[model samples]
Target: MATYGDLRWGVHLMKRILFLMSDTGGGHRSAAEAISDALKIRYGEANMQIELVDVFRACHWPLNKMPEFYPWIVNKSARAWGWGYRLANMRPIYSLNKRMIYYGNRQRLHNIIQNHAADVVISVHSVITPPMMYAYQSLSQRPPFITVVTDLVSTPRYWYDPRVDFTFLPTQKAYERGLRRGLEPERMRVVGLPVHPRFSALRERATVRAEHGWDDGLPVVMMVAGMDGMGRLYHTARAIDAQNLNCRLAIITGKNAALKARLEAQTWNQPTDVYGFVRDMADKMTAADMLVTKAGPATISEAFIAGLPVILSDRIPGQEDGNVTHVVENGAGVYAPTPAQVAETVAAWLADDGAQLRQRKANARRLANPSAVWQVADAIWEYAHAAYIPAPKKSSRSARYRILKPEATPQR
Candidate 1:
């Protein structure tokens, strides 16, 4: 048995971790970075080497363009996206998709694993998980592999693979979904979605407001759609502004320069601040009394940590559908799809000196797992330490290039 002291001393041995993800959305990369940061925090940076690879970007032609095409796919028609999502979740279609992915990208994926030579591999994206696992199965000496489901509730079927050494679920709902999809109970853990550690270290609301030059006297309502500013943010802002509410507005038009410019060009009824993509979201959330945004898992998790009640203005179809229910049902927030509904929800929360808003804030805080990042880091570290083994001596060039046998291929 490896003693605790022995493991501590082994810290000098520099463990390598490979995080496999895609830029399909910001959440996957953000989750990878949060976990990577957590690992560095737990075991000093020198003790570990972490690399994030956009697996889809490294794949063959059409597959490689997935990251680039994702936004268009969602933006073009959410109903179409939802249809495809549901279609792919069918048992036969899912199996066929896995086979096609394995056959198409096995060699490239195998090359990725060989080149990276990691002690542990983690997948944060649903689309790449199955194919990556298939490639890992071909290796004679495979390390531990983990799947951290970034979706809060309605996780896609592609996210679950029984062969994975471990699966980290963001919520109990997600874990149940995995169980229904055949993931062993013991192999899956319901750890909350990992957000930046900064969210956990929120400062006093008034202090943060003071630092940001926001008025402490007025209630702050922060509105954000996403990094891409995908939803009806401008209209929603207009609706809220038209309400003539006493609260101040902090609108974050993230990476949407046009939207920011447009919002800035306008005259408002209230003390409103318009900002572009900001790095200090944690600070902004801390300063705000409430958050109005879409149902993105990462944003929701961050809001939970900040204890800010969310007023969901929009959500992507399929995967994000359940997130709305999770928030509203948990009493952390309400799902108001239309701009008028969002305005109404906001106005209602602001009533009675924000009595309802405070209750929602308490609920959000109760659902938060502020230490989730650290917990996930600790689990991954344990897996890495346990799975670490000395690399075998180099084989002949011909032997190294040998393909996986049919008998060794992974099954559905």
Candidate 2:
């Protein structure tokens, strides 16, 4: 038998992990990628085979409306989307919607579960969890089903399903919410959200700034418009440039080609560099003194991991509100919803030898959960060794409270 530290070396057979995510938002895919990287780092690549399966695109048809409508509502009609989100949070509405989704994608769910023969099936999306648990119950013998909630604090009703063997939450708030939702305390572990391990492996800020040809003495403020670059990028950049705070700007206009072109064409008051979709995000983050972006859970978590303080410009309604609160309450950063506010916050932080700024940065680092990736990997490995059988359900249609404990419970 293989020891815990050296499973791959001892076993000839490789274990397969299937990560189920939908493209409704970028966070789920990012989380999947983080776990995949963590597995390779901890267990040799030869030992573990990780496959990221986009559940909605590959399996669930028609029910993929969430991904399709997400960008539309977020970009075109945010208020309407917010109203819809609030409506969805109501128990009857949420339950009805969930059932429709599961029934609509039932066959696809079954196919995904049976076809992959995954040693461990992990879900990072909220909507997919119950269906995944239902599908897992269908199998005569199955691998453990784990749910990793992507949200930091503001989790919705659909995020908690009782069928998962182990639930990994990112914050104490999430764990508390899980308990409120009736998830067993033992099954829920408050392992912070996994960021890409590279964020943890950041080079020194001064070295990175020098490499990027940035002035080492000037404050480096990074403005990110999220992966889609949906926010008011032009206005925010202009606001920061207007400030005479002796600062330089590193603007990450993620995947917004038109915006990138426009920003590059214009002359800036402050020393500025504009980038399209970035691959070396960690290095850029490392070179910065502060981050100005939306209240995306993944972005906030990644910035925390890089020890970069943030100024949240905006957030998706309902889901991302808690992320902003998490940052402000924890003193990791502040909430600045407008261009003027963002600039003011940046200018204020850049002054006084950055004494207050340094404190906030320290707070950000304190909230940093850089070890989350490895912690999650360890949990999965630990669970995989135990005897976990899919509990028999009284009714397939109604998901009851099922305890997913191992037959022989290991003492924590």
Candidate whose lDDT is highest? 1
Clashing residue pairs in all predictions, respectively, total: 0, 0
Residue 399 alpha-carbon offset, candidate 1, angstroms? 6.2
Clashing pairs in 2: none
- Estimate the TM-score for candidate 2: 0.90
Tens digits of per-residue lDDT for model 2 on 1-412? 1111212335344566788898887899989998888888887788776777777775554655667778777988878877888898788998898777767777777666545656677899987787677667765456788999998898987789987888999999999999999999999898899989898788887788888989557888999977788878789899888886688899988888999999999888878999999888999888888999999888888888788899999888887888989999999999999999999999999889899899988999999888888899888766555554755645654342222333333422
Best by TM-score: 1
Error of 2 at 116 (Å): 1.9
Candidate 1's C-alpha runs over 4 A off are 1-11, 388-412
